[model samples]
Target chain A: MPDKFRGNLLALAVMVCLYERPMHPYEIVLTLRQRHKEESVRLNYGSLYAVIASLLKRGLVAVVGVERQGRLPERTVYCLTDSGKEEVHQWMADLISTPTREYPSLAVALTFLPVLSPDEALRLLKERALSLETRLVQGQASLQWVQRHGLPRLLWIEAEFLLRLTEAELQYVRELIGEIEAGTLEGTDFWKALHESQELSLGIILSEKAQYPEETGIRAGGQGTAPRKRTRHG
Target chain B: MPDKFRGNLLALAVMVCLYERPMHPYEIVLTLRQRHKEESVRLNYGSLYAVIASLLKRGLVAVVGVERQGRLPERTVYCLTDSGKEEVHQWMADLISTPTREYPSLAVALTFLPVLSPDEALRLLKERALSLETRLVQGQASLQWVQRHGLPRLLWIEAEFLLRLTEAELQYVRELIGEIEAGTLEGTDFWKALHESQELSLGIILSEKAQYPEETGIRAGGQGTAPRKRTRHG
Candidate 1:
């Protein structure tokens, strides 16, 4: 699905892949790497498989059939559902026609705030919050799901992160509505702050872009897979 | 590429796309929708062709061959180059790795400000700034080549966005160094501002995630994508 799809990128990529051919996880990874390389694809075994499994549950993707071999675990050959195809097309059309805010991949989430009326924005937030809340509860519902699952320890943290964020959105939207109700929002600091926030984000974005000098050729720092030490998961 | 990738989501998505099959413009648009629907990948026809041609020239992607059907224009199949592959991987890897200051995206940029200097932070910013300068030059050269072709009107705006960004970076870097030279930065509003800005941005990010409400579905404002007096593209 294009940007208009209003979902995640890797999920869509996974769908595109499944749509192309029913694929086992390993085969999917293989094809992704082959089309270009693992580096460019920015996919790894851990995140990749996790997203696949999630998609399977969402009904966007499913196991059309299975592939088995002697030694290794039986492989699940997944394919995009009709619903998934519709999601892709619907999103693509949205991209072409909508004048909605352009959401950036990771950090651009904030930019979408002004795109909707506060009510609509609040509704979307609540929707996301509910999903995150479900993930927080239902995901950790069974001890077996948590214990047997070899997800990054941070997987749990992501839900928590979402919970915090939605709570924050709930607060902000309330504040926004309060402002509107009170008629205090007109030319106020919050509005200005909201506006300035865009510049600040842009500034941050621009600054990041600036860090890379145009003249020099690629350096060691410029290449893939800069390793990490985690603090909190988002 | 991960969110940590130096480039934004769209740029990373485009890079990841090259890892797939070689695509002409229409195909690129189709491919993007087919895969990453959330990206809402949109391009004026000019930017699409221009980005592809530059990617080809930069060795990020290679033109394997071209095909011409009866009525349509020629289509060139562009494959990602080795360097492109490496860069993409680096971006992906960095997304989850490389812990630094809290909220590394903006903090990383601010670190370059001389006003914020501690010996270690200064050293980090210097290293980062130096690296950024190199990339900026290369990016500019790439944009220049893009302009050499009959450039699209909006495409130039994108190019200018990049260039102006680079210019801002250079300016900031210089300003920061000067601030370090002057004693004013240490006790200046910058310090307070830094703390406030960080709190705001981080708060916004976290709040959006945690505060966003659960979906109570809603519809549009009765009107569809209809033309209002000066609706979209205004």
Candidate 2:
């Protein structure tokens, strides 16, 4: 019932692992790695014990017993309590159900990309396409491995989501690159002027249609007409 | 240059605005809001001044002059420095070009969903589908508004990306719901036994194939034959 556990993915993963049965922190780590849950859960081995301890204090998990294996150190095994089980379901439900606001850094960057010059933008975007190409190849290989090993769809659905997003970025960037190379990108004139810090008439407006509030419509000492209409594919 | 400004999206936006011409912070805020950059740049009005101060100290921006409008307080206008112009291009380039590690919370939750019972998962997933449906509707309206207003594609590309992603999530969630309702989810049997805490045999392996290292596999005191092969659509 405590709000502290909310959004703590590691704690959630820990509880989920224990739900299968009682597990020592070491086993939890190994299970997560072997299952390839590593992509989703970024865990610190040292902090995992701390996460389990906090769960114990919160009564979400109970220390069922200590186990010793073949000359190894004694490990405290933990089990998910009934409350823990309920919490996992509710937490996962909230997480998967809700569309939260996330500030993906690349998304933010792309939104403000007009700040850069066309050539510079093209150069960097080319770099991006190359990076994405490499990543796509790697992603394809890993996805195939998941399929080859016959893992459940539930296990690697996130990988598919990531792959889709990466593919989208690549496609968009490549198209933008093509537009830039062809000198057909929307607002190219305005962007080029700004990129070169060139002077223009007081009416030269870069934003299409002058749709922004008049007060915020930066005159920039330019008398400019509206930029050309552009579509997403344009 | 320094990596300090690599993730500073707000500063980047501010400088981008200033690159158009000298502007007061109020104008910067208005421009960002008017341009709908608020979705990507999370800014605190009070902290805008602090960000500007930091940028000034870092020589990315320099104050030009003060302007008084209609008895209002004289606002100090700032312009992007030459280095600032260079920085914006480099920063934008680096951001657009690099694929950073993003910890999307939804992706993390789905990876560990084995914690929830099939029924609970279905219930939560239904809730998710409903939320996504509402979001998809809103996103469609917003996209239409952007198109109707004749905003350039560069301005709303991020929104387009977001809408696409939301659509994907909705589509995937709906498919998952269908599978769950039909009682045909790949790991349903394995998940159900764990959900009910029922004893399963080793022959009842949850995954379609037993590919995990033996040492890390959770025996759970039951033998599981392999679960069925399930595709993303399955």
Candidate 3:
């Protein structure tokens, strides 16, 4: 993998475009947009030009020709050099064959689940499950639309991968919610106890703050002190 | 939900820690490490201090006291302000319920999988399957170790979430590899033909560059011109 192209999918996309044939930066962007590659790769005119310049510097791509259409400025056509072709293959191989550690935001939230009351956590998980279900339906519809139109699956395999991930996550979250609802989730009692104790202390603090609002910075609608009456579940 | 704390999980983590009790920056780091929260949260002394300073500036946390042990400088103990407590709950809820679009590198690679030949893609997918399997095994073993030690499920639920995601990806990759190997992957023939035509053209270009190495900037080991003989599979 080329060091210059690391973590820059736009660069890879540009090289892939050039590998098909020589194209100006604008043409590359248009082709990518036409193919809807932007769904996976972030694209912008400035970054596209920057990626092209870096590729040119690395000799992964070269100027083949320039095109000027009417009032438009001359756009330099770029073609994939041999090194560029090699780098694309090696980089794709590395990406496909290796599993790098990624910190998903959901994982971070789950790590601190105890911070939220058990009931609140359960409510949030149910909300997430509903959202995931909506997305899965939409994703499936799009995948089917592409297939019905006779578009090759290879073009949208990434969408399929994302759909599968969402499905797994939704299933996990649903099961977690079930466990909490059934009072079977380990440490539910402890989690509830912890929240109850905190609520008791918070009640005391809120009463004191109400007496001396100025000293505690507790202005109306300022300190999120809305009453949070704990609701018990069967 | 605080604008200042958006996408800043460290700030959220700090607030969660202070919710337990007021602690100096060093103690916060120690507690997070002890709980193995670093597995999910990126932790560093520098970043932790920066997050603390930012929280202070935002008034999400306030210095409550200072402590000095021996010759050490006074360490300021910070507590979560009322707004900070409210922010943590809102942030956690938002993160759990909202499914934000994340650009995983694998998705980007899959978008351009056609850049590699069918045989190469298959080989790389098989390699990926092996790596995923190894990780799943290690992840399961650790999760089991935690369970065996009587650790609360709440503490390691994030690890479980990650393991499920890996399992899903591995299953999808294996199915993809199987389809490719069986010659049933959509557009396999087209993909093969595309690569074959490119290989033929590449052969011609390589020979041309080899003849005029100086003109094309093809130096020894500089231009990645290593022969790539097409290997057909059954």
lDDT tens per residue, model 3, B41-124: 767787888899988988889999888878877889999999888888889898998876666778888888877788899889
Give the per-residue lDDT of model 2 (tens digit) for A167-193. Answer: 777787787789778877666766678
lDDT of each: 0.42, 0.69, 0.73
Regarding TM-score, does 1 or 2 come out ahead? 2
**What ordering of candidates by DockQ runs from best to worst?**
2, 3, 1
Off by over 4 Å in 3: A1-5, A22-27, A43-57, A62-79, A199-234, B1-5, B24-27, B44-50, B63-77, B199-234
Q: What is the C-alpha lDDT profile of model 1 across B88-107, one tens digit per residue?
A: 55554333122111121222
Window of ten residues with lowest summed lDDT in model 2 chain B: B216-225
How well does model 3 score by local distance difference test? 0.73
- What is chain B's TM-score across the candidates, in the order shown? 0.36, 0.74, 0.77
lDDT per residue, candidate 2, B80-192, as tens digits? 89899788777877788776656678778777666566787788888877877776676666666656766656666666666666666677778777977786766666667
Worst 10 residues of 1 chain A by lDDT: A202-211
- Give candidate 1 regions above 4 Å deviation: A1-7, A37-41, A95-234, B1-234
What is the fnat score of candidate 3? 0.55
